[model samples]
Target: MALPWFVKRYPDLNFPVSFPPELLSHIIRDVCYNHDPRHPAFRRACCRMTLVSRAWQAVANSTPSLWRYLLVEYSTSQLHLAAFLRNSGEAPLFLCFRANAPIAADPDMVRQSLLESAVYISHTIRRWVAIDVELKDASVFHSVLLYLASLPSPPLRVLRLACAVPRHADRRSSFAYGFHGPTLRQLALDGAPPWSSPSPPTVALTRLSLHQCSWPNYSDFFEFVSLTSALRHLSIGTVRFAGTLPATVVHLPSLDHVDLLFGSNVDSIPVVASLFSRLTYPALLEVAISFNGYGSVSEFLRTPLAFRASSARLSGICSIDEDFADVYHRLFGVVTLDLSHGQRAMVSALSAEKSHALPLPSLSTLLLYMPNWRSLLDVISSRNDGQLAPLHLRCNYPEHLAVTHHLPHIADHDLESHHRVLSLVSSFSWIHPM
Candidate 1:
């Protein structure tokens, strides 16, 4: 058979030519990364891409950059997760293992698998910057910690463990174990009392998030914070303590931002105000107080806390605890007030008198939710502050992450959120990352 017209015209080119290395790289990226269900390559062709040659497949299967943000939201069993972890030589930045199934495996196996996988993840932890892992069961926390302790590189920067974790499975195995998370900066632990101990997590963490937890009494809270001399940022949601926040908590020199999510029993107006007055957040920039997961907003008159706040954000200050509202107005320097969660929200007082209306000397951004077009427009158009360069208006939902272009006026951007999550789960063929 004769060559095609195009092939005949180009005499310099080989008859049945493959792409050059540079072109091949681009082509492979498109096929491996851009290909979808409808318009796709054959199944065999996908596998054949790897077998094209050893060196090519090596490039095809592994891209060091892609390992930075790995999300393991696998729908498979723990055993499968363990197997994959055992083989995954590349380190991932982020990994999420979400399995809500009831406890089905032996305690030791479950714990061991989690430990091994965590160890594997830790190997990459040094390479990548941040990690957000979710495990459903609390039984395997020891394993996770054990593995986390083994990482020799990259300090664990920010860690959010929303999934429950067992506190101590081997009590007799010596309760004197403690890991100094020199690299750990931000930590969010949402678990029960039965699952953890009162030994005090002594990580050099700055940002700490407490949600749906087991710190029932002041002693527990004290013990937890005792190890947090470097603690700065704290976010609390739904807790019923019999006593007040310890004096030591307020004494922490580094403590700054506190996101308080008040439970029905814990939401006291006077106490809320005292938390603001008593503590020291010299560099404290924002305060996002939510109630029952609902975001709220308030206009506060100039106060010590408000004046210092360059970008104070109070989202989900539910039902407007009248007592706290009084203190909220004094926030003078606040530049942003996010009230996206408008439903089930009641502010303490929003003065109709424009003159009396609390002014944010630095205020520039406002986030609000709207039902109709008119509301959206009104919210968008309401920002008169010339300094407010970018005003982001998002829907008002309790749990939903209000997506908008407006981020913190300050830097220290949340790169973790911007990272590509889905790429980690899929095959590594497409990645040409640096």
Candidate 2:
């Protein structure tokens, strides 16, 4: 087999190798797969492996899995693309096609090159396990979508499509395609095409993420999700909803993780309530919701959506009324609470005296980003009244020593002072720095 151009250029350079071909192949696979395929370092490392030694080159050439991840760009030469595809053999491929605004002298030629590459890969659609396409030009986007739409059914497991055009731009022509893959398990769409067809064979999907997508009505959104009964993770952000709210409540028995984000639009409040009230997921264990609009946090808390999660992250809340205290107390299943963003009102609500019951009685962990040490101290002391388990607190304070002095009331409890880091799980820590 012919070596890649980079490897052939350095044919005489060989490094000493002690490990067997099998072991070396295993090491190379681990290193290459761990890093993201879109990163330049990943491709560079994959090419560099062949130059390590003749034994390494032979092993790399023989291993089909090493070349299965193909990143095709506008500048990717035909030789490189063909070499990777040939060496990948019949292994399921993870394909990523990126077509950004070209800086080349001949912009039309660059786009044509991208279109040709898309057509070239169309023959291998049956072996595609995952495909991620990101395009900035509308014409190029339409061409790529056309190629994908003409392809036969693939064993695709994941599909992510992103369009960088402005929302006001005419995207109807570019996004007028439906995706259908029975084996698809993950789908992520960002300013991309909408699946308007009645049924597009997404029954096996376990994760769905939609960002900056608009629907004609609320029912359209619900109707799409009602199909993914086996979905485990659902994430929606900055999605626009219109028309009357749907009465149908979609039941997702297998869903466990949900992340929602609302932009600064007052109309979203009712839509948010409608969405939460409509969906019922019994297996849900974690939820993170952010509100960037003007509305009462209590309005969403009043929804029938089960807040029966072990951990919950709530942020972007501006204020809370006295009724919020009552609604907040209902989240009895939440053991860990994250109030790291604009949630000082929540701290006050938790600290407030209620003649009936304590807010979040089952809560044992608290993550706060409050600058006020006195209020933080007050809440900690109030919650540790011996009725509930000791609160494990993690927060950021300007003066660590000053906060430590004020913590004499609940000093015996598990207290952690974070300078710039909060110990919340990386996935739940979506709040940007203040």
What's model 1's lDDT at 82? 30
Q: lDDT score, residue 272, model 1?
A: 43
Steric overlap count per candidate: 18, 0
TM-score of each: 0.45, 0.59
Best of the candidates, lDDT: 2
| Residue range 1-434, candidate 1, lDDT tens digits | 23323224445442223322221111122122334313444333434443213323343355433222233322213233333333444333333332333332344554344433343334323333233344444344334534444444333332443334344532221111222222321111221122123423323345555554444466554455544456667765544356666565454445457566554444433344544455556576666555544333332323344455555665554454334434553554544445545432322233222322333222334454534324433333333333333233333443223232222232222222222221101000111112
For residue 289, model 2's alpha carbon misses the true position, in angstroms, by: 1.5
State model 2's lDDT. 0.48
Q: After superposing candidate 2, which stretches have Cα over 4 Å from the reference?
A: 1-30, 33-65, 74-95, 98-126, 135-153, 163-206, 226-230, 306-311, 335-337, 343-364, 382-386, 396-434
Q: Report the CA-based lDDT of candidate 1 relative to the real structure.
A: 0.38
Q: What local lDDT does model 2 show for residue 83? A: 37
> How many backbone collisions does model 1 have?
18
- Report lDDT per candidate: 0.38, 0.48
What's the lDDT for residue 78 in model 1?
27
